[model samples]
Target: MEISRSLAISSWIAMAIVLSIAPAGCFYLPGVAPADFQKKDPLMVKVNKLTSIKTQLPYSYYSLPYCKPTTIIDSAENLGEVLRGDRIENSPYVFEMREPEMCHIVCKITLNEKEVKDLKEKIEDEYRVNMILDNLPLVVPIKRLDQESSTFYQHGFYVGAKDQYSESKDAKYFINNHLSFLVKYHKDVEMDLARIVGFEVKPFSVKHDYEGEWMEGRTRLTTCDPHAKQTVLSSDSPQEVEDKKDIIFTYDIEFQESDVKWASRWDTYLLMNDDQIHWFSIVNSVMIVLFLSGMVAMIMLRTLYRDISKYNQLETQEEAQEETGWKLVHGDVFRPPANSDLLCVYVGTGVQFFGMLLVTMVFAVLGFLSPSNRGGLMTAMLLLWVFMGIFAGYSSSRLYKMFKGSEWKKITLRTAFVFPATVFVIFFVLNALIWRQKSSGAVPFTTMFALVLLWFCISVPLVFVGSYIGFKKPALEDPVKTNKIPRQIPEQAWYMNPIFSILIGGILPFGAVFIELFFILTSIWLNQFYYIFGFLFLVFIILIVTCAEITIVLCYFQLCSEDYLWWWRSYMTSGSSALYLFLYATFYFFTKLEITKPVSGILYFGYMFIASYAFFVLTGTIGFYACFWFTRLIYSSVKID
Candidate 1:
C-alpha cells in the first residue's frame, strides 16, 4: 500500500510539471503564422482596428474609405478577440523580405459626403490606425536627438491631423496619405534566415500632382517616383474633406538589419515601469497583512486560549453558568442563517470565479497568455469559467446540504444560472447599445449564440453532474451542534453594527490592490499594453490574504458579541470591497477618463459595474471560507459538552 501511494504521488508530480510547462511553447499569436522568413519571401501587412483614447471606441480599418484589397479576407478571430473589438483584415499594402521600395502608390479614390463626414469625425476623435506584420504590431518611431536611434514609439499613428485653430479653412482634415515603413530584422546566422523584430512607420500628408491617370490595373505618379527619394515637405497641402476630394495612398519601405534576437523582440513593446510604484504597492499590502497577522496571533494565543481554558476547567454547573462571550453561544453558532439559498448560490458562483481566476493567473504567470497571444488571455478565462461549473455545483450543493436543505436540484439550477444569467442580460443590453451605433465593438450574433451554447450545453451539464456527486456524499460534519431555539442576541456596540463593520472590513482589502487596479484600468480604457503578470499575481495573493484576515478578525468580534448571524456577515464583510471598487471606478471616470458622450459614459459604468460584481463574488468567497475555517477550528478545540 505504501509503495502504491508513493508511486501515485510521484506520477501526479510529474504530470503537474508537464502541465506547467506545456503552454510556454504556445505563446505565439494565433492569427499570424510566419515567425521567420527567408530572402525574397512575400510578407503580408494586415490592418487592425482604429482605436482612440479620447473616444475610447474602436472602429474597423475598412470602415473608412481609404483603400481596400481586391478580396478582403478577415483573419480568423478567437472568441476573446471577437468580444474585444478586434477587426483584422487584409490590406492592399504588401512587402518583400530584404527588399526596399521607393514611394509606391497603393490606391486612389474620391470621397463623397458620407465618407468625408465619417473620416472627419474619426480624425476629430483622435483615432489611430493599427497594423500588423508577422504578428508584430506597427508603431511610429520617434527619433532620438543624440544617438539617432529609434527608442520611443507610438503604437499607432493618427489617421489625420485636425487643425482646429489654424487659418486653413480649406479643410480641418489633413489625412495622412503617405507612409514610410522601416522594418527591422534579426539575422539567424545558423539557419541563414531572418525574423522581423520591429515594424515602424512614419506618416505624413501631402497633396501630390500625379502624371499618369489612375486605373484598376495601371497607375503612375510623378511626385512619388521609384528612382528618386521623396521626403516629407516642410509645407504640404491639406487634403480637404469637400464633396469630390480625391485622396491618394502611398508608402515607402526600407529594411534594416538589427542585432536583437527574436526572443527578446517584445521587450520593446512591454511597458517598463519605474518599479517604485509597484514596490510601494507591495510594501503597503505587506504591512496590512503583518498588522492583521499580529492581531490574529494575539486573539488565538492569548484571548481565545484563555477563554477556552477557563471554560474547560469549570466542573460545577454554577461555574458553567458564569461563562460568557463566544463560549456561551457554542450551541447556536452553527445555526444556519435566513435566506440560506441565496448565500449558497453566491458561494457557489464565488467558487466558480475563484477557480477561473486561479487557473488564468497561473497560466498567465507561466507566460502562456502574454501580449504576444493577442486574445488568448480572455479566451482562456472564458473556457476556464465554463469548465469550473463543476466546482460551483459541488460547493453550493454541499453547503445547501450542510444547511439541511432538501431541494438539491433547485439549488443546482439556481447555481448554474444565477450569476451567469444576470451578466448575460447586462451584456446583451450593452451589445444592443453598441449595435445601434454600428460599431464593431458589438459582438456578432454567431458569437453570442456560441456563448449561450457554451453556457447551456457545457456549463449547465457539468454543474448538474457535480451537484449529483455532491448530494450523494454525506453532509459536512459540524464541529458543534445547533440549539433548537435561536439565542436572542443583546444590543451590539456601534462598531459591531452590520453596515459599519462590513464597510470597515472592506477597506483593508481594497487598499491592498487599488494601486494595481489603476494600471489594469489604464491598460483597458487606454490603448496601452500591460505585461506585469508577476506583479499582478503577487498583488492577487496579498489581496486574498487581506480579505481573509479582515473577515476572520471581524467574525471573531461578531461572535464574541454573542451575535450568531455570522454566515451572511462573513460574506458581506469581504464582498463589500466591490462597493469601494465601484466608487473608485466612479472617481476614476470623473477625473481620469475623457468620455463625453452619454452612450460612452453608460458603457464605461456598465462594464465597471459587472467587473465590481465579479470582484464582490471573488472577495466575498475568500472571506466566507476563512471565517468558516476559523469558526470550526475554535469551536472544535473547545469542550462543548
Candidate 2:
C-alpha cells in the first residue's frame, strides 16, 4: 500500500502547531494570579498583653485591659471627676458608624440609709472616703435610640465570668438580650461578645481584626480601695448605684492596628510554589530531548553498520543462498491463524484506534487542544473516536477479508461490538456498585443510559459506514506471497520472551509517575487539596516518552529475536503501562489510603480499572504505531530477493 506523502507532512505540521500553541495558551489565559504574585498584608488589630486574675468572687476569673496612646482627649480631669461618685453628663460622639448622643454616667454608691449616713459622717470627718467599690459589673450600651425608633439595641455588655465556661444567669440574660438586639435592631450586627470576650481576656491570647468597629462597646476595668491600699482588677467592673438608679460604668479604651494578612483560600502547599512549573517543564523537555537523541543515535548507527556490512558481502555465496532477511517471513505476514478470526478483528480494531490516537496526540502537541481550552482535550478525543471508528471497522474488515473469511457480516459485527461492549460491561458493573454505595461521584443513571444509547445508535452506525468504505476499497496486497506450510518456531532466550519484554516496557513509564501518584492518591483519599499542575504536566510528558522508548526498544529486541508476531505484541508491550498504573493504584490503596470497607475498595478498583483501560489503549497505540513504523522502515531498507 502506498503512503500519501502529503498526508504525512500535513499530520506532522498539525502536530507541530499543537505542541507550540497549547502550552502558550495556558500561560496567556486570564485567571487567578499565580501564588508568587500575591502579597500578605499586616493584621488589623493588636493586643499587647492579657492577664488572668483570681478575684474574691466564687469562680476563677481573668481580665485584659489594653492601652493606646492618643491625644484626642487633652486631660483626665473630666474622667477623674466622674470617678468621684458624682453625676457626670456628656454628649456621646458617634463611634463605629453608630449615632452618638448625650449619655449620663451616674456614679451610684450602694448602701442602706443607715450605712450611707454613717459613711457620710465618716467621710466628713476623714475628709476622704477610703472605701471604694470593687467587683462591679460594667454595663455598656452597644446601640443608640433616635426619635420614636430604636435605631439599634444594646448588643450586650461583657461581664467577667467566674471561669471561662462559668455561666451566670445574668450573663445568659444579657446574651439573650444581645441576640434579640442583633435580630431585631440591626441586620448587620452579628458579633458574639460572650464568645469573643473570653478569648480576649485570656492570658497570652492575641486578638486581631481588619476593622476597628468590632471593638465597639467593649471595655476593661481595674478597681482600687484606698482604705485597704489594694488594687483589684476584674474583667467585669464593680456595680455602682446613685440615688436608686443604675449607673453605666466607664473604663479606659484603647485601639491599635496590627500587621498580618488573612490566609489564602487555596491553602494547598503543592500549588503555592511558583517554581514548580518551570522545573517540571524543564525536566520533561530534558527527558524528551534525551529520548529522541538516543533513539536517533541508535537508528543511525545501526543503519550505517548494517548497510556497510551488507554492501561488503554483496557477492558472498552464503549471503546469496540464505533466504532474504525480511522476505523469508513474508508468507506468514497476513496469514490467518485457525479459530482466531475474532482475535484478528479485535486486533485490527485496536490498530485503527491506535492510529486515531496518534493523530490526535500529534495534534494536541501542535496546539489544537491543551489544558487551556478546559474540556478541549476530552472533546477532541471524543471526536477522534467517532471519526476513527471508520478506520477501526475498515481495518478489521480488510484484515478479515485477506484471511479469506466468508463471514464478512460476523467480522463486521464483532469489529463494532468488541471494544464498545467491553467498555459498556465494565462501566455498567462499576456504575451498579457506585449506585449501591450511594456515592455522588457515580455517573448518573441517565448518563449510563445515554452512553448505551450512544454506543448502539451512534457508534454502531459509524462502524457500519467505516466497514462499507473499507470493503469497497481494494485489499492491501502483501509485499510477498504467503506460503501454504507454516515455518518452524525458533528457540527464545529468557529476555527475548514476549511476556518479559512487555513487562519490562511497562516499568519505565510507571516509574515516572510513582512520585506523582503519591500526591494524586493523597488528594483522592485523604481529601487533601492538590494543584500540582506543573508536576502533573511534566509527569504526563515523561510517561509518554518512556512508553514510546520502551516499546521501541522491546520491538527491536523482538525483531532481532526473529519474532514477527509483533503486531499485537507491540500494542500489548506498550499497553503494559496500564498494568503498572493499576498496580501502583492498588499499592496506594493498601499503603497510602485510610479507606475501609469492601464497597469502597471495589469502587476504587473499578474506577481505576476504567482509567487503566483508557491508559492502556493510549500507550498501546503509541507503542504499536512506533513499532509499526520502525518495522516498516527496517524491512523496506533491507534487500529482499
Across 533-630, the per-residue lDDT of candidate 1 in tens digits comes to: 99999999999999999999999999999998999999999999999999999999999988887888888999999999999999999999999999
Off by over 4 Å in 1: 1-34, 143-151, 166-171, 212-222, 229-235
Task: Report the number of the highest-TM-score candidate.
Answer: 1
The CA-based lDDT of model 1 is what? 0.85
List the global CA lDDT of all models.
0.85, 0.46
Structural similarity to truth (TM-score) of each candidate: 0.93, 0.52
Could you give me the TM-score of model 1 versus the true structure?
Answer: 0.93
All-Cα superposition RMSD per candidate: 4.1, 21.7
> What is the model-wide C-alpha lDDT for candidate 2?
0.46
**Model 2: what TM-score?**
0.52
